[model samples]
Target: MGIKEFMISFIFTSILLSILFIPTLLTKSFAGIRPSSFSGHPQASPFPVSFAYLISASKGDLESLKRTLCALYHPANYYLLHLDLEASHEERLSLLKFVSAHPIFSQVGNVWIVEKSNLVTYRGPTMLANTLHAMAMLLKTCKWDWFINLSASDYPLVTQDDLIHAFSSLPRDLSFIQHSSHLGWKMNKRAKPIIIDPGLYNLKKSELMWVTKHRTVPTAFKLYTGSAWMVLSRSFAEFCVVGWDNLPRTLLLYYTNFISSPEGYFQTVICNSKDFKNTTVNHDLHYIAWDSPPKQHPISLGLKDYRRLILSFAPFARKFKKDDPVLDKIDREILRRNDGQFTYGGWCSERGESNATCTGFGRHENSGVLRPGAGSRRLKALIVKLLSMRNFKRKQCR
Candidate 1:
């Protein structure tokens, strides 16, 4: 071939390659780069306070888990998702992929998956263990004011902005846990029975194994029980995980054979410890609707329960059906999130020419800014009433 012909062919090939690679280059450029906030600033300020969340899910709850994560996600907070060992391999893998692929999660680097899953048994100490496990991981890896344990079946009634804003002025050492020394029927039904959890030693999941012999109630520590869900202050979480004092560890052994240990473990621990007992706020901060008589589980909420749930002024609610219509109402009204997007907050803002919001990195300087809405006011009112002298002192360790 002639030299001229060879040179012309080489130039044309180079042009073709550049054109093909332009899209690829554009996509790669955004990798790990923080997106700009809506104000055209590089990022928005963070909220004054933050929460570290442990979101636990069992088999067949992948969709609900994803929805809950999206709704609760905020750049300032940390999240650890735990899919029970009983969940299918596909479900666990899909959840991991969703967290990894999420553009905002990748950049913020706050979301995590408990790759080493635990076999959890309902109403057993294993449930309590899972909560503690996540707490330990979060304590080791992140710094936050509070640790919130939620299940896939639960949904947020307020946005992260509203939550942070409402909590900003409150005492930092306070723990929002519902507890009472009065055990009622649980004293006989839950405490007396000695049971074993197979999940502790076996690979398979099973119900608690009841023993023929019953044990007397203890004098070492008072037994307290209430809702399993809670918002624990970092100081209290450290006490449970670190156990500088042996109370947390001692009670853990006692509750090992107790029924529904998750409901009592933290409650008993907080109430028994002098350092943290006064910090207890005696509210779980979740709105749960019980049946007329109340059963093993709270009733699954629907559109009909929307008003009551909102008026309750709780930040979170539980036992919702997957993709329930009431959740849609929350997205449209309370959260201002459309279709599976993150709830609106100061750290994230809508960018022009892009449908995505909060898919950006926020500057440290922008931290502590809040864009709280009506939900914030409602939550503030609830907090005020709870912290009132009549309610706060009257409800503690009663």
Candidate 2:
């Protein structure tokens, strides 16, 4: 939908929602929800904020995917898991079955798997297309304030309660995107090179093919590049998915031939738009550490980075080993999640008291329950610093 159409729709919905549930919308409470608030069912009383997560994984990543999903899962939130076409059919079926067999997932029915897998090349436009495809699906499916795209290798440092509580006081329009207009060396290598991903046309997976000819960077719209991970607002997600104006579509076409499109597509789109240029907080909300000199790809995080990780106070960290001991340490210390159980939250904390794991949620419905912890305090402090006057304005679209 276009911006005008979206505004009209949003106004109409808000009017009705405001009339029906004025108290809920006007709340600025970080004090977790209570059972006494709801009459009979808590489902009718939605959380203050929710996120839509797209977890993308490829071959040999089912276990990692499961662990990450469990850590990131929340009853109030929606999750869409995409397994690349490179994985076997049996593997995809296994993932679907795992989700279906899970007690919390089956009961809450908030998790979904992308049955129609797409061939995604590492740095090709297919990766960008896959992300957009998932975004379009989520935009049509559920209601969420923010859209976060993460890979299976990425893990959350804080509980979902911490994230939701920390963001409760902020404006919904703010998007956490690390971006800058300066391309530096990328101007010649990434922006000028032409590439064709065989994943687009071929049924099977293949490498990204390079073209001998190079084209000049377009003067119509300036290029921006940064971290591929982003915390996108629903408004921005809709604009990119629907192409309300020509900027999104024009950038899509331009970046089709560009290398590492994911790092630039959303950056270029958000910065070039007049409506969204100033609505950005210059951070990717991730604690990603690189090698001293930095290689072609980031180095995998291990136990050695634990102290620095906590100091960063970012909600998520990435490029971890599948079964890294650091993950276990983070689970025990930060997330409070057990080996195979979902993350510790008020939603299921009271349910599985016998084993003390968040296993079953159908017996006791506490989807509205949100108990923030010390991690919440850390996250809030970090966000406050990022949105401080000195950091917010100076780093935006620079």
TM-score list, all predictions: 0.86, 0.87
Residue 363 lDDT, candidate 1, scale 0-100 = 48
Candidate 1 residue-wise lDDT at 99: 78
With candidate 2 superimposed using the best TM-score fit, by how many Å does residue 86's alpha carbon deviate from the native? 0.4
lDDT comparing candidate 2 with the true structure: 0.80
Model 2 CA deviation exceeding 4 Å by range: 1-45, 351-356, 362-367
Q: Give the TM-score of candidate 1.
A: 0.86
Give lDDT: candidate 1, residue 7: 41
Which pairs of residues clash in candidate 2, taking residues 3 or more apart in a chain or in different chains? none
Task: Give the per-residue lDDT of model 1 (tens digit) for 122-170.
Answer: 8877788778777776766667889999999999999898999889898
Which residue pairs show backbone clashes in model 1? 45-366, 45-367, 46-366, 46-367, 46-368
lDDT of each: 0.80, 0.80
- Estimate the lDDT of model 1: 0.80
